[model samples]
Target: MPRFTVFMGLLAMTDDFVILVVDDNANNRFALRVLLSRLPETEVIEAAAGEEALMHTVTRDIHLILLDIQMPGMDGFETARHLLMTERTRNIPIIFLTAVFKAKEFIERGFAIGAVDYLTKPLEDNLLLSRVRFYQVLHARENRLADVVRQLRRQERSLSIALSQAEAANRTKSIFLANMSHELRTPLNAIIGFSEVVARSATIGPEDRKNLEIIYRSGNHLLALINEILDFSKIEAGRVEVVDEATDLGLLLDEVIKLLLPRAEQAGLTLLAQVETIPAVVRVDATKLRQVLLNLLGNAIKFTRQGSVVLEVRGDPATEGAVRIEFAVRDTGIGIALADQRRIFEPFTQIVTHAIGAGTGLGLAITQRYLSMMGAELTVESTLGEGSVFRFTLVAQLATEAVEVPASKGAVIGLAEADRGKRILIVDDDPDARRLLVQILAPLGFALAEAVDGMDAIARTASFCPQLILMDWRMPELDGLAAMQQIRAEQGEKAPPILMCTANVLGEQRSEAIAAGSSGFLVKPVRRDELFAALEEQLGLCFQRESTEQQKAAAVVISPTDLVAEIATLSDEIRDALRKAAEELNTSEVGALLARVADDHPHLARHIAAMLEEFQFEELIALLHA
Candidate 1:
């Protein structure tokens, strides 16, 4: 019996495949099973009649059915008719087992009922196995095709759902942006308007004047946060571009450091930059790369209160064709928890939310998107209390050949003395932003003027006869782009260097502005140095490099006594540090240092406990004297 079973299994393996044997004869069923078992993959299922075969075909995954022409109740012809009419089992291949011989009419009748092939009374075993194997292969292919069709249908449904969800999310985001614009601009207008009125007032006391300065600075910082959000949105939508060009990486790094150094200092934290190596020349999108570096360094300095925020660079040999540089910002501040590390990079996700106050929280998200576009990746390694290190590699196209040294020097061209009395028109709907620009330029001896809207700006231009017009995008009645176009139309080629002073720093917006007759762009809360530099460049000023010390000294210098008075006026963390330092010393140099510290790390508060241990009475007093 065991040997017989082994022989049957071997025969089954040789020609085994699924075959439905349907007949009223028990002998016929047994014979068909034995015959099919001789072939490989042959799994013969028995059905006593046509009705039983049709039922089995519907219930199980039978590939082929051989039906007897004459059964007791439901004959082969009627079963085939039923199977063909039903959708589920219509595609099952069928073969007819008949005693009838040579009538074309009977053959045509079987073909009409979906019989693919037929056989006579005495079955040929070789012919039977051969036909069964042929149908088996065809059936397997159909099964696979059916599965593929099902998968495609499922994928189509999934994509439809996803697309709908994305559209809804986009609508919500659009509404959120509109609401935020109004909420932010309203307070910003008052802060800017009141500060301007006080700053320019000749009758205001020095103390009152100092108070106004604080209001102006805070407002400006808040404005920067709002603008960052707008730019980030544009970037995520793929509307931002890298504008690839030869960039001065060192100068870019220095500027970013200069902007954030004051904040780091205010927190009693050192800001350290280490350039172990830098590519002498590499092609990059200077503006976008600056945004990336600024966001990374800014976050590092904001989080690191006591320890230094270190920026380190290294060369990557793999990216030899285009110089690959590795940049990392390491900080020992309140490091992100392991669980929150991934979330930290997401938009609007601030780890120490209360500590790092008043940001739109889009900086890191923008940086990530920017890096991705450049075919790079950013990763962070952190421990909850230890610190975090954010590192990314950038491949900037290397200059094919060496360029002139003068071009590489990043020299800042000073405006000729003629700029002093030149009339300027500032067109911005944001009153605070306009005020900031006026204050920065007015000191440089320009006859500054402003317009609240684009229409007013065009009207002001005719009489003002401004040498330069700093236009803001996203204004009511006429936006910066439309206004610039109108201005260019009226003035033709003589549209005096219309520069766009906008928070919409997205590349498309920049190109649109330039196409509309803007000579260049300056991103906002316009840095004083960049603002002047844009003016000089647009006004065709000759280039001149200033000594670093002279540049630092020339910046609006606030004395320690004056700064302490300013610090004494505030209610923030930095202000509290100054008050503590003031009680310890007779003078307010501690207040000045606090003021300086506030300039750098406005979000940080000095640990009074640490201060007690670090300073002696005279040592602390000397800081006040400085």
Candidate 2:
């Protein structure tokens, strides 16, 4: 059909349409064909008799037909009669060619049988083509409309089918969610219940108690996974909310560090905290803030097996208004693949690696959503086998409308030990962890006492009259929050700084623990430095750092003459700068940190380039003289 339209369109321009010559006499047909050939782009088909002309009308494809009206078994009238009777050829325009008949009767008869006009013999070529082109345009337009109608019908059917398939897929997803929710929640409730029971029971034997600690840890881990999944669903559904309150930003970070250090240590990694110079308090949904930090840092620690995870704060310190503080956690673990970097932030997508364990894969997905809600964004920079730095920024409203204040010398790490002779109670369900924690705290000038559970802790609290109480939250007879509530009812305003310890150190949990009478909270496997800092800050005890003279008295001092030894322990910036100079290696096109390195450590200024190149001792000794 399209090809026929193209042919007609070509004919329309060239004045070529269909011209049929019909006659019983062969001479007449030949003469007619020769004359009509003068018309450009016209097609002439010859019929020797009326019968042949009728066949052309009924079967051949053409726009118009010319009929001869004399001398045959079927005359022009009979053929025209047949054309009109049949639906296939009825609409075709017919012009009668009659040389012998000028008879009015014959003309009228032709008109009665559906002939449009009669042309006598020796037809003019121009007159014949002009009539053919007229009908050709009419027929072409009809064919174009028919094609458009067919296309619209096909599109209508396809759209209906697609809509039906989409509806079916939605129904399947709904059903799956309903069934899986039950399967997940039932097992989670049991794990949390039994783990709490064992952790609270004082009668658990030492060997069995270790096993119980593992069980409780695993259960808490399970609970964390479930909570993450639920939170992700809410986020995907656009239902997560951030409830704001005036919060102590410094205290919040203290809890986050304590929670993450154990995981960092288990993987043999280092975790360090560097506080920003800004207002210590901020208005935020403390719960959401914590969740965002934990997710970013947890993923950093999970992927990083070595090196250090440093949490540094960056922000605008000039104004007490909405602050642009960033929490960046960096680690040197298995770095994310370049291709999977963007995909890792999407739900249910994990980097395809055998070493990285499986997850519900919503950590970063939820983290990004939470940060975005708080007018913040998360950014990452990483290289394959090199580690990643995940940082996010938030507008933290100041706790009070005041300009920045320098931390008091007492507020910042200077104080005297008034509780030097006081006893301290440490309650935890895990003995190794308890013993390890005691080892770190016992030497800080306190008589340390122990308790295996909350019941034991409460009993020891009364007898020991301890100045400090470090409590573990997930334990037996009572959980830490419940135990603290009971103890607070008795102690009233005298309640010491009761700290709660847990592994899942998300923001929501911390706020709940703090609201339930916890003066502070720490994450498990706490680092010694952080532990002491927490003890001194929360308990108001003094942590002694040896002075230069004190170190000399203890024989732990280094001589000032040892220039090489002194520079080796300096910053890597100085070391690299020194090494590059000694090796004569060109550094990056950007300016080096030479000036800053000199300002920070003046004694190592001359040796910066040598240290950067890792120059050998003898080479450095020789370079010093040269």
Candidate 3:
């Protein structure tokens, strides 16, 4: 009895443990309550009828129930049946009490209705207390169990959130790694490839010119890749501030197409555009918009094989004469599967099966992010082995007049013409680089002097008294920074404008250059246009040709008809050789044989050469047939 009383106290100590007593008569309910009331902190809810008992069980934690067999409306058996049917009260152990000892069948009926046990009305106090104590212990266990379940649920939720955050972190890290690989590999490719070309070239031969050309193209590609990567990182970090201005979307698209035409033609893919009659000018971040469009078009060209890559611009006439610009790039290439579609947009995620070469895989990812920044959604439709079409829309205000928007910083800058025949100094440790710079600048009407190192550059600055100095930023002895400082200290403000020519695109590199008395920075493997732009900026030098870059671009677009004409006039032996070359996919043989076909087919030769380079043998054979 002492142990039973202690158990009862333990149950009451739980405080939330509850028991229900139901009887039609007050005396019966009072007797049940009196027994339960002995337990400290235990709650006993009394009901004179089955309905009141059900209400108490529903609203409270009724762990145990004591019922009267005969109630006024719903009898104890019916009540027990109802309790088993309800979730809250179903698990509560019920004991039925009767005025008389029930027959076997009557007792069996009580058990069938989910009554835990039966007790006569003239009950033994000890027996009743023992049964109550047993169920009380069970009720306390269930309460503790429920509390544990709730705690586990909370932990599960916390774990779910942590896992999600970790997954997102992994994705970000993957992007950073992929970009770093690209940034490092692209330049390395050029440096190594060019170094090989130069190292192998002891004497000028037939291959020497081709080697030099390869080196030039590789370096240019490396420079472009580095600049793009730097731009992507800066913009992703929100470091590159955006300037919104009027932009000609049509013109921008045209520039992108022109830029990629060489690549497209090389792949033997037709590049086409469709511009619906609508306003083309709009106000946006011109540089970012251009970058986005360029990236998408570039990806389309990169992935596509033979069919046409089309850029379509269809704008709706919006309110107040504004425009909703829609841009789409469609290509015939290896399309994405449903399972990999979303994964491909994630940075560094590439479909390895469709991969033609090494890539950073950041193109579409960067495009998607740029769209999001501009509050646009990127949509894609693709089928395996078919093609893909990527699209986005922007709400743009129509430009009322022409606006001259300067390109983003670190890009080529142009200036008005200043005094010609200005003495300029070129400095670099490498003889090839100095020769290259001389070859680039000597033809520009500038009196040029060369320096092999920083010390030489400083000496030349004093002796030559140059108007501008193009110094290498990363020389071996007395680097550009120190040399510039020394020159500035000697010549004071009258010192020539020192422009750094280096591959470094870091922000601090430019900052340090300026702090050390440098005028501006020019990225390495400097194209002729970029060199002119830098000179114009510092020396006010206007280029001779107004459409210089355009001229260069026009050289890239060869007439297909001219190529057909050239193929038509080929001799029988040369034609057979060309066909054999096409079948074997030998670009060199095809070019060499075509060189003698027609003297006026220079551009067509280049086109065929490009196709041959890209291994578009099918197209090449077709062209020879034409």
Candidate 4:
């Protein structure tokens, strides 16, 4: 009973234990049932014959069986044989009872039939009850083990489902970010590109040019915000990798300063660069370094309202041609509280009381992650209401002479004489986008043609026979990748070098463009210099340059006040059409409408045409509204 105690508790909590008694003699069955009744939570089913025993085993959850030999029809050996032959009742323990004295023969035959024990004539009640109790304990353990296995299987299924759902959610987030980036950059391309074109105009007055600069800077600021979010996503997905290359530390630092100089000026904060000692060139991930520096300096400028923000660098030559460079961004403004210093590096965390401007709060987190990937740690020191310094150190190899940074090139005025008149095709769905490229390349003395979509571009490619093709990635009817594949299949090596110029800024999109036979990739909001650079690389074209005086003399100055007056004199119908076209930023339609006004006033048409060439839709819209 002591050995049975543990199992009895387990069996009481579960299903009842069933015992089947198979004996032709009713009295024998009754005797076995009375003996089995002593066991707790046990039920006994009586069977008068072997057939009845088989039925009871199929219908009941039998744990053990008692069979009597020397019965009327089926003997105990035959009943045991029948029970052992079936799959369901095979594991049920059987004890045989017989009224024979042939111990040697009867016991051997009964044991051979899978009986647990053989009892003679008059069975001992205590011995029978003990065997039943032992079987009951074994049955209870088997049931508990099966339940545990079932529960484990259920948990495994739940975990698998959760993992699948998480994977799906991640995929959805990635797609959403990519699409949002493209949608944002599409219009920003026009905003930044047109502003840049206007800012470079020598005809615009100094004050007008300054306002244009503000617009240009603001457009770039929005673009940077978009990039910050996308970059954080890339880091979280583990898609970011450090690509080391020859980088000019001085030039890189200069570029960052130039980019942030206007913001510092607008904020009335003094920005300084203190370089103690640095190499001419170092091997590192220039893009990541630029991003980290930009984040640090940008934050410094943002938090500092009245004081100065300084970027200090010190480089010392280290072992194996490596230079240990330490960078520090120090700002005199409202400093971080001691309690919130560590939390600043965490994603989307901001000290509301100390913050001075709006931000995604991921800048420092991303900066720290980028530094960690480059095998460096970012540290901060700050005093409340005083100032703060964020610093990091990295060891980079000195670049060889072969890795020298090329000097910045001057502005490209036109193509070289030899490369002039080369056929160039521009494809885009947006009319303003196509006009922007036309305005840039057409004036460069190249033969430029426009296509509204990928299919149109393919048709023009064969008819116009362009030597270079600038194709947008997304479009209706067909996409850039599919169109490029078709052209490559049709023309083979005869296909022109296709530059994928689109708003898609994702890394995979760039890879896809190259794999689809694109000669190069250029993101939207492309600068005049970047477009020229891409053109030069692909077509091997040398661009003609003009000095400041020469460009100024060639420029035409148009006064917006006079343009609005000239528009007022035009017919109401023509004026309305012009305003609508300007609102839509449809440069082609506006050009056509302006042609109607050319006959009336050549001077007014010329000025308006100049604005259209510069993609000054905003100015035109304002003038038309006035």
User: Which candidate wins on lDDT?
Assistant: 4
Point to the candidate with the largest TM-score: 4
Give the lowest summed-lDDT range of ten residues in model 1: 605-614
TM-score, cand. 3 = 0.58
Compared with the true structure, what per-residue lDDT tens digits does model 4 show for residues 1-626?
68578555434532789888878878888878888888889888898988788776665668888777777776777777887888987888887777777776988887887888777768888887887788889889988999999999999899899979977887887889878987999899988888887777779995587567667867887898888899999899777899999888898999999888755644445777999789988899999999999999988877764568999999986668999999999998679999999799988887854324567789999999999999899999999878899999998988885555675555687877888899889988988899888877887899999988879988998999989899998899888888888888889999999999998887888998998889999898877777888888988888987776776676454443454566789989998998899788787888798778888877777666655643545446655666
TM-score of 1: 0.59
Each model's lDDT: 0.71, 0.67, 0.73, 0.82
Task: List runs of model 3 lying over 4 Å from the truth.
Answer: 1-211, 224-238, 277-280, 318-323, 352-355, 397-401, 405-421, 429-431, 443-445, 451-459, 476-478, 482-492, 511-517, 543-606, 617-626
lDDT of 1 by residue, 301-377 (tens): 66654557888888665364677789999988668888888787689877665534337778888889888888889
TM-score of each: 0.59, 0.39, 0.58, 0.66
RMSD of 3: 13.3
Question: In each prediction, how many residue pairs overlap at the backbone (N, C-alpha, C within less than 3 A)?
Answer: 17, 25, 2, 0
- How are the candidates ranked when ordered by lDDT, highest leading? 4, 3, 1, 2
Which residue pairs show backbone clashes in model 3?
417-542, 418-540
Q: lDDT tens string, model 2, 51-157?
A: 77766654456567777888668888887788788788788788887877465788888998888888776667778656655666665676678678788878878
Better of 2 and 3 by TM-score: 3
Error of 4 at 1 (Å): 38
